[model samples]
Target: MQKQETTRIKKEDKVKIIAGKDRGKIGKVIRVDKKKKRLLVEKANMIKRHVKPSAKNPQGGIIEGEGPIHWSNVMLICSSCVKPARIRMNILDSGEKVRVCSKCNENIDSK
Candidate 1:
């Protein structure tokens, strides 16, 4: 089995798609699947599902929703730079690890 790798991306972070049909699109991170190394970005990588009639849904039909995209395919958009940039881990004086934007050298973590 493949080991689950850690990701710098987190929920609510803005990201830009670097690859795939959704390339160049930007969206907020909705969910993260560490086991699959995939992210569910809002309004990105949309997929359709055929749902059968169930108690929850009296009318069964097609459903459109965001699909999981590989984490490597998206780049985090730096809040300071307002651009998609690489992230590096930084250890602050307080010993708290935080993500730093490579382009602007700004802390990605919100206070």
Candidate 2:
């Protein structure tokens, strides 16, 4: 199936995990992968990875890092409401588009 190229959750957006083991976790969006429909939330959904010793590192060990979570598993937190909320898109009279929070009707995106 073709994935949507644009996502409501953009870089630097605060989001709350709504499902899976990381449910209820809140974190900022570190990255957005539209092609894979996944988002890497900072300090959330952490996973351990084993890395081999390289020239940069004298020892190989396991490290914990944030893992990418599905877009569907997270909900954008409305700045106005300070809680997980849905997004609504609308155009202004000036012909500019804005993302609005469904719960508070506040413009979520400044740009």
lDDT by residue (tens digit), candidate 2, 1-111: 545455788899999999989899999999999899999999999999999988776697887899999998999999888989988888999999899999989999863
Prediction 2 TM-score vs. true: 0.88
- Which 10 consecutive residues of model 2 have the lowest summed lDDT? 1-10
Tens digits of per-residue lDDT for model 1 on 11-104?
9999999999999999999999999999999999999999998988879999999999999899999999999998888999999999999999
- What clash count goes with each model? 0, 0
lDDT of each: 0.93, 0.89
Clash count (model 1, backbone only): 0
CA shift of 62, model 2, Å: 1.2
Model 1 bad stretches (over 4 Å): 1-4
- How close is each model in CA RMSD to the real structure? 3.0, 2.8
Q: List the residue pairs that clash in candidate 2.
A: none
Clashing pairs in 1: none
lDDT of 1: 0.93
Worst 10 residues of 1 by lDDT: 1-10
